[model samples]
Structures are given as C-alpha cells and as structure tokens.
Target: MDALWEGFQEAVRLIVRGDAGLREVAWRTIVVSGSATLLAMAAGVPTGYGLARGRFPGRTLVLSAVNTGMGMPPVVVGLIVWLFLVRSGPLGDLELIYTKRAMVVAQFLIAVPLVIGFTAAAVQALPAELPDLLAALGAGRLRTLWLLAREAQLGILAAVMAGFGGVISEVGASMTVGGNIQGDTRVLTTAIVTETSRGENANAMALGIVLLVMAFAVNLLLTAVQQRRRR
Candidate 1:
C-alpha cells in the first residue's frame, strides 16, 4: 500500500512538472489511436449499415470474416502490416514501415473488424419493423439507412467506443510498426514497457496509471454519450 501511494505521488509530481518524456508519449499515443479510431469508424459504420440492411450474395461470408477478424491476435496484425510495409514487400515502395503512419495503419486494421462486427450486430438487433416502416414511407435507400442509424445510434456509439478501447491499449502492433523509437513513435504503452524493462519502475507505474485513467475517462465519456442518445 505504501508503494502504491508513493507511486501515485510520483505520478502526480511528474504530471505537475510537465514531464517532457511522459507528455510526448501521451501525445503520440493519442494521435495514433485517435487517427486509427476515426479511420475505422469511417469505413466500418457504412459497411456495418450496409450489412444490416442488404441481403446480397456473400453477405454472410463477409460478416463471418469480419467476426473472425475481431478475434485475430495483435501480434499477427503487427506482422502482417510489417510484411506489407517492409522493403521488398508489395507495398514496400511506400516505405511506411517503422513509423507513426505504419502504427496508425496497423491499429486501423485492428479496429475495423471490431467496429464493423459490433455495429452490424447492433443494427440488426433493432426491431425489423423500423426498416420496414422507413420503406413504407417511401424513403430512399440512403435516407432509410440514415434513419436506421439514428434509431440505432446508441449501439453505433458503443461500437466506436469498443474499437477505440481496443486500439488505445494495444502495444504489439504499435511497437512493431512504429519501432517504439524515443522522441518519435513511442507511446504510453510502449514507453511503459521500455521503462519497465530498464527498471524504471516509477516511470512505468506512472504511465500505467495514466493509461488506465485515460481509458476510464474515455469509456465514461462514451457511456455518457450513449445515455444522452437513449434519452
């Protein structure tokens, strides 16, 4: 208990002092995770809506694939991204490996299936009559989708929060794709690992605390948003 108290004090001191290294890691973590989450939402939300409303051939296969992807190992995601971005690989000419952009790409891929699967399930769970009612009103397909989305807004928000939660805490893909370079790609998770490995327990503990607090805050905010939507 004393150790924990001391760690908290140390973390507060660091934060109060504006610890340069910690701030840098926090900034990088937010940038990478935020960008990835946005990209995932942009792609996943529409795909999920389409899946919920349409019954084309191969739709089941696609949804199944998305569900499968949600369970994929982070290490595998890292390795695949690394391969594609590494020299001599198909996309090697882009030279995206071992960079912040690469980390964003990796996290984006990791979050996509999560958002899609969750959002699709959410949309499908709504009453079938909702879509039918929209159809009866002579609403176009696009407007119908929009109305359906509004009706299922809470679930879509939850899906986005869930995706953000996944990518925000991940270290495997971030480290592998970003190289965890100091003053560059290092994020809170990667920095914690690096500091811990080097016996900087105080710093590592501080970062861990910050990561937990930030994640908690994000979830709380998301919950509030969902509650507002429900009302």
Candidate 2:
C-alpha cells in the first residue's frame, strides 16, 4: 500500500511537473494509435460494408477470417509484421522496421479486424430492406452507403472505440516493431515495460497512470461524441 501510494504521488508529480519523457511517450502513443485507428476505419468500414451487403461467394469464409483475426495474439501480429519489414524481406525496401511507421502498421493490422467485425455486425443489424429501400428511392451507391452508415452510426462509433482501445493498450506489437527507442518509437505501454524492466517501479507505475489517463481521455471524448449522436 505504501509503495502504491508513493507510485501514485510520483505519477502526479510527473504530470504536474510536465515531465518531458512522459509527454513524449504520451504524444507518440496518441499519434501512432490514432493514425492506425483512422486507417483501419477507412479500410475496414468499406470492407465490412461489402461483407454485410454483398452476396459474393466465400463471404462466409472471409468473415470467419476476420473473426479469427479479432482474436489473434498481438505478439504474433508483431512477429508477422516484423518479418515483412525485416532486411531481405519482400517489403524490406521500405525500411520501416523499428520505426513509428512500423508500429502504426502493426497496430493497424491489429485494429482492422475488430473494426471490420464490429462494423459488419452493425450494418447487418439494420433493417434488412434498408439498402433495397434506398436503392428503390433512386439513391446512388455511394449515397446509399452513406445513409446506411448514418443509420448505423452508433455501431460504427463502437467499432472506433474498440479499435482505439485495442491498439492503445497493446505492448507486444509496439515494442516488437517500434523497438521502444527513446524519443523515437517509445509509447506509453512500451515505456512502462522498459521502466519496470529497469527496476524503476515507481516510474513504471507513473507511466501506467499516464497511460490510463490518456486512454480515458480519448475514450471520454469518443463516448461524448457517441452519446451526443445518440441524442
């Protein structure tokens, strides 16, 4: 209990004193995770819509793959990404290994399936005739998609929250691909790991507090948006 209290105090001090390292790690975390979430949404939303609305063959198989991906281990995803970006790998020419971009890619892969699965479920839950009704009313394909998305906005927002949550809390993928380099690829999760490994328990706890706060802040903002939309 005493140690925990001291760690909390250290965390407060770190925040109150505007610790540079803490700020850097927090900002990097947001940027990398935020970018990845956005990219995943962009790709996943359409893929999900197609899966939900289209009647193509192998659709079931594809959805099963996405469901599997949602449960896939983060470390495995990191290893796969690392393999692709490593020297002598097919994509090695881009030299993305051990960088923030690499971390974003890994995190993006991690978030995309969750977004897709949630989005597909959301779209599927809508009135079965919604798409047909829109088409009968002469709505273009893009416009129909837009209307359906608006109708399913709540589920879509939930998808966004899930994606953000998954990527923000992940450590193995970020550490493996980002290398947790100081002021470079270091993020809150990886930073906490690094601090704990170095036996800086108080510092590790402080970073953990910062991470929790950051995650809460972002989720709070999203929740606000979600609730407002509901109203």
* Candidate 1: Cα lDDT at 75: 76
Best by TM-score: 2
Residue by residue across 142-198, what tens digits does model 1's lDDT show? 898888888888889988998999999999999888899999899999998998899
Q: Taking the tens digit of each residue's C-alpha lDDT, what string does model 2 give over 1-231?
A: 765777799999999999887888899999999999999999999998889988999999999999999998899999999999997788999999999999999999999999999999999999999989999999999999999999988999899999999999999999888999998999999988988899988888888888888889888998998889889
TM-score (C-alpha, index-matched) for candidate 1: 0.95
**Which pairs in model 2 have colliding backbones?**
none
Q: Which run of 10 residues does model 2 get worst, by summed lDDT?
A: 1-10
Q: Give the whole-model CA lDDT for all candidates, comma-separated.
A: 0.89, 0.93
lDDT score of model 1? Answer: 0.89
Runs in model 1 deviating more than 4 A are: 1-3
lDDT of 2 at 196: 88
RMSD of each: 1.4, 1.0
